[model samples]
Target: MSFAKVFRTRSFRDVRQALLEREEIALVDVREEDPHARSHPLFAANLPLSRLELDAPVRLPRLAVPIVVFDDGEGLAERAAERLEELGYTHVTLLEGGLQGWRDAGGELFKDVNVPSKAFGELVESERHTPSMPPSQVQALLDREANVVVLDARRYDEYHTMNIPGSISVPGAELVLRARQIAPDPATRIIVNCAGRTRGIIGAQSLINAGVPNPVAALRNGTMGWTLAGQALAHGSSRRFDPHVDDHVRLVSADAARNVANRARVGRTSRDEARRWAGEAVRTVYRFDVRTPEEYEAGHVPGFRSAPGGQLVQETDMFAPVRGARVILADNDGVRANMTASWLAQMNIEVYVVDGLMPADFAEKSSGPSARHAPTPPAVDELTPTELRTLLQSPGTAVLDFTTSANYVEHHIPGAWFVIRSNLEQALLKLPAAQRYVLTCGSSLLARFAAPEVVALTGKPVQVLSGGTNAWIDADLPLEIGETRMASPRIDRYRRPYEGTDNAREAMNAYLEWEYGLVAQLGRDGTHGFHVI
Candidate 1:
């Protein structure tokens, strides 16, 4: 049977109806992140074609769940459907006319990454009336060195990139737990900020909800707002939260977080309860350790994955792709997990925090379930860094680097051609007929995944560069720059308008205007079940 006959085709109206009814749906965008970010419906989850096989089983664990894949007429949906079938996904379909069809049907399209969560944040501000201060007010406080501590609720790396003149990296969930130490005097004012609206509002409210005595407010629109106001941000700032927290502080913080969680109606789960949730066949359960990355790296529950509390709240869809999934959070101190669970509960996700799981329940392992569950990749020949250097001298041997496009442009092997993993077959046809092919990425994991496909396509011996480019750089090898070779279009990554050094001011303003209109769009659609207390 033809694809049209075998799998159902869903129109924009059909998908919107499913969303409105609150049925389980995985409206997956099968294109790479770049195009997916440019335009897509609010609820669409991005599972790029490059990593479909690796991500599908975890993100969409239940095979029979409804999945509708779409692309911008890139002809990727058919191929994605075939792959999903191979992976034993039962109810896979393609969107009728791809992204363009949604536009034609009067469906509202959004720009940038994490649209649903960001839009919900805007709604929360509109509904809950989260307190805030404009960039100009914040600048006056900083100029006078006022009794205020600005906390950046974004990841540390983002804080390091650019920040308010004196902001410290406390992240989102850490705001309630770490606030007292940063601002000992109950009279001091606290201001929280992130790259955009979501984290800033959430972080500010976390402190207020936790009942901190000091006044609290969000930096009106975060750093974006600061920039739009023509305020200069500090670049390469190293300010961080003090890591040497005392036991007494930890206990008090945990107590405060627990009280906030109680108000939000977050439930407490035991080990057996979490296990039972995980065993349920019909409902999806996500187990996460809501702690600092360092603590998680030191030791964590064997089955729980590391999702620091702040980032999880900011990027809920990426972690729990299935909207209605059950999530059980773990943390030794209980502060981070409870704070994070409070936000997730408000988001209408069924969430729980493990109350008193023992340290013995954890193992000292850094790998997550995704890596452990990855099927033993098909065997392929391997080459060491020393051996690969000799092979590069050959005329007919091609070195294909599967690293991200931005990284490829920065530096690569002298003759390496950047290739996307999913586009390997087509990319191979464009290469000169070579005797052997060598694959490399940052860690060689992706290269290994692509090796079998490369071998089958060219009928040539394919080998992985052991330890990948990191190893090559460690060995003092010469590198090339500036898109020296390209077998595929640099379409894998979407550069964010809010990120990097030279963002267009007009684009940033346009992005903010788009975000401001999201609540109105949500009113029109009526699918997102976001509520703020």
Candidate 2:
């Protein structure tokens, strides 16, 4: 059947103008979280094609309106429309041109609350807020520049390849948790850098969100930009790690233990209580509904604001700046949100965990969001061999070696592939068709997250080696531990320079402001644009 028969459609330019005019249109985007972050049209809300069906029941009611979706390419748009139709929605349309077609139509693109793109833009244009040292204005200040801390927020391996002379290694993903360790002196002007732009900007802004006293900014793009500005990149590695974890900030409990289910946090309340909180005051209690944004907008607790679990945990101070104020963390799936609360508790922040608390949309609608980020915990103390062995028996069970590819080559599991924390998901996609998914990280945290993503996408059951690779080794499992890699990945590097061959001046200005404050500005737009296949 033709997709057009199933979906109404529109041109990108038409949709763009409609959004700007604030017409009653429901702009929907169907793409994964990360890709949506990379690039998309302005004002597109991400529903991700995979979640279109699950979200439709709630999705339709919010929009007594029209929805438009896009895909990277192929018939994904039509397929998605079909799924939406199955749920009985009748008003969605496809973008006439996929992202590239829109791009061809002079379709302006946005990084969609993307920190990296802003950071990269900042790196390219140095005319912004970079604690300037123009020869004449601050010659003496430059001479007396004895107090500044620089951090590199790219992957540590990238740090090993090349870094700024005195910067510290802090992965962007780890910034909010480890910021204090990197910049102990709140008085210091904290500067962040990355190999390119995004991580540095995201990292810097995350610190500000966490309430770091230092005025944080990206090093205008990072080592790449530094080099373009006639600076040299350094070689060799530096000590990397948060200086320390607060001993007092010990884990009261970890994982999906029963205690995790009952833990308390500030904003969280019983379902009845949450409904009451929503009625009391919209601004007093910052109720963060920790579900995907699509799920939130379709319907949420009346007074609640939207913040995903991972981003919220990493940016608590930014969302709720008033310390000692209340915060409620909620999720459709209770366990993972509770697991998060366990960590937040040790962070010494007052918080709460509420189960069965949902938006008013839940009462009005009958559907749910697609697979949530929650991990289902089995009701068992030790992982049973039966479960473990079944996961191993599947030929397609992905064996991800968290160790470096080099370590992988030295002798790892025979069929397992090498995937570092930074690039694990991208690799998972190209794996041979598998019946189930298995993962190995140093411990279970990475697996806990990654394995579930597969389930969400492919609906496959996933398990990580219980103790990670160590568990495999402890059991004396048989397979290659270290046998030199058979081949190297065939990949090349490319750079997209500031192609100002044709662009409005306002965009260029926004790009410049973005660089100076990349860290502090991610997702501030509070809207999204995306197209994926």
Candidate 3:
């Protein structure tokens, strides 16, 4: 089909709707990966116009599926569509005004989109959550409370380059885990701000999105509002005012790390104890295999959960709130899971490392015994693409495509579903448990690390894509593609209050003294995180 004939143009709202519904459409941005990763459609999968080879069609499941492509004033969408047509992708379209049009339409974009559009949509639509705060209200609250916390959601370098006078730098993803460290009082108002509106909005929304009760809001129009309001913008100022004062060494001994790993209060199940915990006699054991989202999606041990090591480490409280919930860390190696287990143990959270469940690359990443070990996984047990396609037709087999969202969009095995690794739980709940579960990714590693956890969550028989879908593609397997997907909740309307970290406390006298003392020692200290002024 001609680009004009088959294109179903979508606005941000339309795209969001598609993403919300989990429709079968591909939102293709014709920009390169790096720039696009910084800010683009939350649901849009990227395929640079420069590489729309006919081989691309072989990657996708169905060439007939709608493929909407856009460009960021690069004037490349038309070329991309034309190329797709040449590749026998008859159903191809382009954004009329390109990326700029989407932006002008108030399309929901993000800074470094983390979760998939569907996963993020689920996060955005999570009920019992409030919408973001209007920009004015956020500013007003910050003005009213002199001590109110205004946190910059960008990275450290970004904050150092330009920021408000008193705003603290707390990257958005870090907000939840570190909240207690930034804001001391639940009563303290929190205001989230970023270079522009999206990050601030989403960052604030993430907390409120998770049902955090603190009063929080996003800076209206971002720092531009502050500037327009006659407030001065600060730049090139001291990056670290208080200076880091930690005396503890970054120990790398495996034994030392394991000891630290043993201290976590969550996910502390020992290999021997894990089997017992999963027994029918136990009250309930939520088996979670902590690894990269890839490894978990690849294939986990039976009766386990799939969560990334980083998120599991950071948000252990949210995933396992039952306090004593049995937690297991499944990696191909013992390093990370062990170290993570140790940290969780130290935190008073019960956790354990699944000795045999480690994925590959653990040992290489580990230098000292104290460093986390990344275990290599066993040879992948996978289903052929044709087998996967047949299984999808079965009464109870659900296929989860565990590749990066963009890769999944460019080409994925037929009948595969998308699940962002970071938000697997949120995404999984949206699926039906009536089906058997099968996970696939670019590599066997993801499927292997993920399968055990799949069976654990759904109580369904689960399997992995033996070598992963990429292997299937390498064998020239059949594929499918679509243009539309799920939509995100429209949440930018309201003004929410900002409360700082719950764990934040006034620095003790000795802590303050040490901090001041370290301020002078910073030149070659290799210290981290001391922005106190």
Stretches off by above 4 angstroms in model 2 are: 1-5, 10-14, 21-39, 43-66, 84-91, 100-106, 110-145, 151-189, 198-217, 226-533
Question: All candidates' TM-scores?
Answer: 0.93, 0.42, 0.34
Q: What are the per-model C-alpha RMSD values against the true structure?
A: 2.5, 13.9, 21.3
| Residue 121, candidate 1: alpha-carbon lDDT | 82
Give per-residue CA lDDT, model 3, range 378-479, as digits (tens): 343466767876776667777777665556667877666776442356668766655677777787565665565566677766778767887788888788
Per-residue lDDT of model 1, residues 117-219, tens digit only: 7887888789878899999999999899899989999999899999999889997877877898889899899999988788998888888888888899999
**Model 3 RMSD in angstroms:** 21.3
Q: What is the lDDT of residue 70 in candidate 2?
A: 83
Residue pairs that clash (backbone atoms under 3 angstroms), model 1: none
State the displacement of the C-alpha of residue 469, model 2, in Å, after optimal TM-score superposition.
Answer: 12
Q: Order the candidates by TM-score, highest first — what do you get? A: 1, 2, 3
- For model 1, the stretches where C-alpha displacement exceeds 4 angstroms are 1-5, 11-14, 246-252, 370-373, 425-433
Against the true structure, whose lDDT is highest? 1
Clashes of each: 0, 24, 118
